[model samples]
Target: MERPELPLPQLHAFVVLAEELHFGHAATRLGIAQPPLSQQIRRLEDKVGYALFTREPGRIGLTPAGRELLPAARHALTDLADGLTAARQVGSGRAGRLRIGFAASVALTVLPGLLRTFRGRFPAVDLDIREMTTAPQLAALREGSIDIGLLREPPAHDTELGFETVLDEPFVAVLSASHPLATQRAVRVEQLANCPFVLLPRTVGPSLYDQITNLCIAAGFTPQVTQHAVEWQTVCALVETGLGVSLAPESIRRIRLKGVAFRRIEPNAARTRVAVAWRKSDSNPLVPRLRAAFDQDPPDGPRRRPNQ
Candidate 1:
């Protein structure tokens, strides 16, 4: 047999009346009339199939069943209060999980500092960080796998998502330390026109890939891509072998391969940007709070290489 549902108001009334052992006093404490408090207790007793109190002329006392249920009832109310507090904390973005997707290369630049400061400010926010390329980050945001993304070359127009550029840096040429170009102060984008190029495949980062290719075209030549590597480290390694030259965000300078040299690209007109993106429809409270953190302490500005 299924028991009838006991209302919270009734349970609360029972606990109060049990504590006071006086209907009038309990009613005073609960901010209710004596009659209503007595009625609430009677209803709760009926649901539990046990008499919860004994009433005699000028006397009131709990029945054994009431004594047995008191501790459990009090514990239940305490747990409910605690649960509500935690829920409110999460609602306010003070405590909750925030899943963040970021590009692998971002780790070489502002990512570490951004995370350190954000953790200090919101220690209770559990950060779920995932390393992914731009396309996967966008896909994750759309499907709700991630709450936010720090990626490069965000789409110029997207109605479903909001993007804010956090870092914009000029392109630098990656050359073999022994290559003749490495001896020059800077290399013109067109100078690399005849050099075999090392680049990441277009499928991995289509927006950035297009940006680089278009920069080359604007310089009056399309690069002859001779090798493909997914990561900047690999691209630098390939460049070190003198297999080809490459163009990368200035931040890639952090990956110091002994055989690889970074040179400022001439014209300096082509640049790549890192942007933070989130779905506009997302209702996560932490989203805006994290956004505020980014705004307050934007990623460390990219370091410039010394004059050659």
Candidate 2:
């Protein structure tokens, strides 16, 4: 025999009747007349080909089949209600996972503090974070691999992405403690033009590296790059070994290394502008919460001491 379609109204009537146990009261609770309520239950029982409830003069009780099915029925209805609520929240941007990408540099300074504040404010949101270079971060944002990105500067191809400045970080020079300029209170970009430098991979973004090169040019000579590293820490490590000097965002001071010393660069020639970026056409419900996470102000900026 073919199975019959389940009638939602009949199921609803059965659940109400099971709770109230009295037809009149169940009908009142359902905002329907008693006859219709009874008819609904009878229809449901007929569809199932079994007596769901036993009825005697002025009394009602669930049969064995009804007792066995009640728990599953209630669970189904409750799950349906919860699913609908979650869908509504997703539509309104109140719920869902937010995947975020960040440059290695930004993660060291602003990302940590911002994440703590975001957790406090939006505890329910699931945050997925990935460390990527500016190029890959921009690619991830455009391809929908991530919902947002914390990166340095605006993307070179601006038509596909939207950017908002989150912080402007000044450039600083890092070198081994034994280096001559490390003892200076503050060093000028001009003084380091001839020093062997460690450079970020040109693949990261030409404009960013250009900012450093342009500063050296303005200072009167080109830097002699003795080494290149893909990440800031590796570059800093090379600087610590006395391999050469490097220019990095002032925020890099937050990371402490035994042999390294950080000093401010004079005239602030190359400032790194960190921005929160997203795709122009993509819309993720959790974008605002993710943005708020990066915008939270800390009681103090990352600690930087001239001699530490």
- Largest lDDT belongs to which candidate? 1
How far out, in Å, is residue 260 in model 1?
A: 2.1
lDDT of each: 0.88, 0.81
User: Which lDDT value does model 2 have at 226?
Assistant: 81
Give the clashing residue pairs of candidate 1, or none: none
Q: Which residue pairs show backbone clashes in model 2?
A: none
Tens digit of per-residue lDDT, candidate 1, span 202-240: 888999999999999999999899899988889999999
TM-score of 1: 0.87
Model 2 misses residue 108 by how many Å? 2.6
| Candidate 2 lDDT trough over 10 residues, lowest sum | 299-308
